[model samples]
Target: MDKAISFEQVTHTYQANTPYAQNALADVSLVIPNNSFTAIIGHTGSGKSTLVQHINALLKPTKGSVQVLGKVITSATTNKNLKAFRQHVGMVFQFPEKQLFEETVIKDIMFGPKNYGVSDADAQQAAKSAMKLVGLDESLAEKSPFDLSGGQMRRVAIAGVLAMKPEILILDEPTAGLDPRGHKEIMDLAQQLHDKDQMTIILVTHQMDDVVNYASQVVVMDEGKIVKTGTAAEIFADPGWVYKMQLNLPSSAEFAQKLVDSGVPIGKLPLTIDQLATKISQLVAEGADTDE
Candidate 1:
């Protein structure tokens, strides 16, 4: 697979040369493959946020370099066409709905494309399509975004980013504050986007279940450095590392581990409910056969 984003020995420092200077990212290097869903997990202040900001050039590294979507961004590099680069990399920050200030939902969704020089007609068409993509009703297009429900408002905000037709989508805690249904809605939408649109997704989240359910690859960050990188199964295969990183396994995995500890014959650690159910059925079948 082609590299969609790459970081080479990247280091970022906040308030450099000041007494309160803090190293947010330290000697970090990573590669995100194209059209892959990668989850970044870590405790607070673990540099997950700081790392994604570099993808769209929101923050520059104090040392080393970051290459995103074929554009190389470095501390000393200047005069680069950041706008054009940003067009291909859409970032949906936490509480994105707070940024929606347009009088109408449709207008808010169209705002991004318009700023990127998309024609009025094209922008409107894109916005309408995006609204549909996010499962928003056409009737609500003219309604005030602030008047909508929290879930609807979030959909509108996400639609705004989708209207830009970015090749790479970066979601920073996309479901930070929402009800259970709202959380499922947002996560399902993300899965649909990745599956249907084949968009490269980089998700920064603390939800281990979301990572297990959606992410093809997982990256664990700690103390401004990447401590581990692997597939979901590989990362969770060893529960000790997860605990050491101050992270917990998905609920399903944890429960499966409990069953294993209780002397149940679980073949492998399961990451999802379905997997766990199947393993349990297998164990029951084996026991029945043995009794015969």
Candidate 2:
């Protein structure tokens, strides 16, 4: 896969050289492939957030280097296109609803394009496109962002980021604090964006199920360092590493274990609800033949 972002021996501290200079990331290195959906999982202060911020020059590394979109972010030379780089990497934070301070939803969505010097008419066009992409209707354009439901507000904030038409979309706990329905909505929207736009997605979330269902790659971090990185099937096949990292296993992992104990002869250990359901059905059909 093509490399969208690369971190080479990168390290960062909160307050360098001060008494409070706590290390947030330690010699972390990884590559995020282009057009891939990758999830970064870790407990609080595990450096997942710090890692994503480096992709767009939002934060510079205290040591080592970060190369994003083929540009060395920590080079001695300055980036002439730092602004463009930021536009290329759209970041949506946790509880994105908090980003909606504008009076109207349309205005809020247009903020990014407007800041990037797009004309008013073009910005509005971008806003419209973004709204459609995020599953919002034009009727909500004039409504107050503050008055919308939590899920609606979250989508609106995502629209704000989408209006920039970024190549890479980085989300920090995008479904945080949302109910199950709202969480599903946000994730479905992300899946749609990835499917339709072929955009690279880097999701920082604690939701293990999301990793199983959505992410193509899983990157696990602990104590300010990456502990494991692999595909969803590879990582979730065993609960050992997940437990060691102090992270919850996906429900599929648990279900598979139960099936194994029940003598179902389940092989390869599925990692999603659909996979589990299908495997169970197959087992039942096989058992029916054995009884005959």
- Give the TM-scores of the predictions, in the order they appear: 0.96, 0.93
Candidate 1 similarity to native, TM-score: 0.96
What is the alpha-carbon lDDT of model 2 when measured against the actual structure?
0.89
Q: List clash counts for every candidate, in order.
A: 0, 0
* Cα distance off (Å), candidate 1, residue 186: 1.5
Q: What are the lDDT scores of the predictions, listed in order?
A: 0.94, 0.89
Off by over 4 Å in 1: none
Local lDDT at 138 for model 2: 98
lDDT by residue (135-226, candidate 2, tens digit) is: 89999999999988988999999999999999999989999888899999999988988888999999999888999899998999988899
Best prediction by lDDT: 1
